[model samples]
Target: MGEKGEVSAVGASRAAESRKIINVVYLITALDITWIFLQLSVTPYLAKKLGFDTLWLGYLQTTVGVIQLLGGPVFGRFADLFGARTALSLACSSTVVFFLLLAVANHPAMLFIHKIPTVFMHVLPASQMVVTDLTEPEKRADALSKLGLCFGVGMIVGSMLGGHLNTRYGETFTACFGAVGNVFSLLLVLKFIPRTTKDPRTNTESENKSKSIFNLGEITRLMKFPGVTPTFLVKIVAGLPSGIFQVMFSVIAMEFFKLQPEQNGYMMAYLGIVQMVIQGGVLGPLTVRYSESSLLIMSIGLTSLVGLAQAYTQSVFWFCVIVIPMMFSLSVFNVITDSMLTKSVPSSDTGTMLGLSASVKNLLRTVGPTAGGYLYMNYGQSSIGLIQFLVNMVVFVYLLLRPLKRTEARKE
Candidate 1:
């Protein structure tokens, strides 16, 4: 072949591979949202129905996250040793089983205990790796944006569906249906995903060498990269608002506002729709036009405003009106922040870096829910907004002072 023709062919081949990898990530994100909605939309109602207190419900979910923090690295190592595809497939399949078990839990302890195993398998490290595996460093934002879009769309659908199902059929039925979705998602991964591993198909002695079950050292080394450290901090900061929103929204809807189960789901569905429109439909194109850093700042700033509104609003209708804009900004913020991290790190370390970050993020999440519950039960719903506003403000300051410079430098 001529030189130019040969180069064109090579580029096309790489592009095709990248597309396939992105498809896998999109599938994972779709499943992830479905699972999250199933958890968020149904779990609180179930807890309430079962006569569990706010603290008990929060403790149950927090226990799930605690296990995830401990399990994520072990799974990361397994992904490295086996293959990401294998680990991801296992994660998908296991989630289906756990969701089924979760469907049957009548007691709080049973529900809490059943939840822990699934948390490990929901390790986001795999999906993040799929993005890094597919795209070049310069193209990371575009790639991550696509993944984020899938999450946004899926979340909307899941929240809406969970609301419909729970309202129509009841919590147990909704949980069972979500399990079925997990099974379907597992099938999608099995059919679409390709294994990306350095090792050969056959096991070698070197690959079999006993590595420490917990390699704090290896994870620490990975974090030392300049690109990784700040990204990790960003993930930690991002976790607070997200965690608070996730845990507190349902509590406020169910407990303080005295909304029915379906009403609560519908409110979340509304948030999901606003977020999806902004993140999935708008943010990707906007990133190409505007400064992603500015968008990030705006999003965080707006979320704080929403948080404050959420704290003080007595009427659900007024709360929804304020929340519409908040959701839009949040959706954009997550896409931007994640794109930054995906762009910062090298492809080879994607799994380890994301796994470590997931551990830390989950740890923060563990705190947010418990704290949010405590605040809500004692001080009332306004406490959620106050805490979220403070945390996001701290994050916003850090962004302007530090990362804004980095983002501007990149743009220039």
Candidate 2:
């Protein structure tokens, strides 16, 4: 082709890639909103049906978290190998199957069995890989913020409506509906999402050597990159409070503040709104203005204070006030961490590095709930806050003291 023809072809290809990214973003948002719509409806009741004590629920959740941890890197690798569309489809499909299985389950053990397929479908890193695939380093954070915004939107809609659905339709009906929604998500993947231009197997020599999706050795080696280890560690710390508090938040609210189900639902919806606002609107603009390292550090310090406030507060009004900054801190921290991850490693190894990040995050998540449950059960509710406070402060100090230049957000 002549120069004009070549330029036209490149433009056409860019146009197609842009369209696909847009489609994937919209579809993922819808899929997640639908999934959260049904999933959260069941969480409040799952333990009741299974006759689970708090400790047992913690163990069960930890087990699920463990499976997800094991699956994260694999999914990352799958996205690298099979393409983000395929890996995401599998994840949604597995979620559909898992919900259906849960609806029919006679025992908690059945829920465990069904979660086997649940591990491999971790879609966050894979969805992120898609963004990384299509965007430059500077653009990846904004792209990722959109994904987080989708999750926030999902949470808001789901939390707003989940209570009503569970009350009106019943648990089995609600779960089955969630399954059907995921089926639609799978169909969306099959129909509208486009395939990648490059074959996964036909990469550069280094990429070819790291071809297998389940290559633990390769993933570990990737951690040695300049900004990779510190950012990954920070993410793990950021995730810990969630593991400790998220599963038990409702319990604490009900117990300490005498909150009702309706109030809890609204509170959760508020949290979702805060997350969406910060991640979708605030985070993207902030990245352009500040270094990711500084923003991440800010998030940690803020969350630490929130944790402390959470420990001392007795009034529901004060508790609700705490949620505002808490959610903001978390949302900003996550978006910045993702941006840092993209900048930490080479372009070709993006998925693999992200996979490792997801894997370690799950490991922390697995440990979080179990340990948090213990602390909550034995010590007190404030114990969760105390630990979170300490952890965030420690991490914030460490990151501030030893900043990595590579993880700074791009200016040019």
- Indicate which candidate wins on TM-score: 2
Off by over 4 Å in 1: 1-3, 197-213, 237-242, 290-292, 402-412
Q: Residue 223 CA error for candidate 2 (Å)?
A: 1.1
- What root-mean-square deviation over C-alphas does model 2 reach? 3.0
Cα lDDT for residue 144, candidate 1: 65
Kindly list the per-residue Cα lDDT of model 1 for residues 1-412, writing each as its tens digit.
6999999999899788768767767877777786778667788877877888888877876777788888776676666555667878878777877778778988867787677666557535777667766555556666666666667677667877888888898878988888888777777777777776332332353255446636677656666655657666766775576676675667667777888866776776677666666656776677777776787778887777777787778898897788767767666776666666545544444566567766776786678679878887788777777877888888888777776434321210
RMSD of 1: 3.9
Determine which window of 10 residues in candidate 2 has minimal summed lDDT.
Answer: 197-206
The models' CA-based lDDT, in order, is 0.70, 0.72
Clashes of each: 1, 0
What value does the lDDT take at residue 38 in candidate 2?
Answer: 51
**TM-score to true structure, per model:** 0.87, 0.90
Encode model 2's per-residue lDDT on 315-403: one tens digit a residue. 87887788889888877877777778767666656677677777776787688768877887888888888888988888878878986
Deviation of model 2 at 205, angstroms: 4.0
**C-alpha lDDT of candidate 1 relative to the true structure:** 0.70
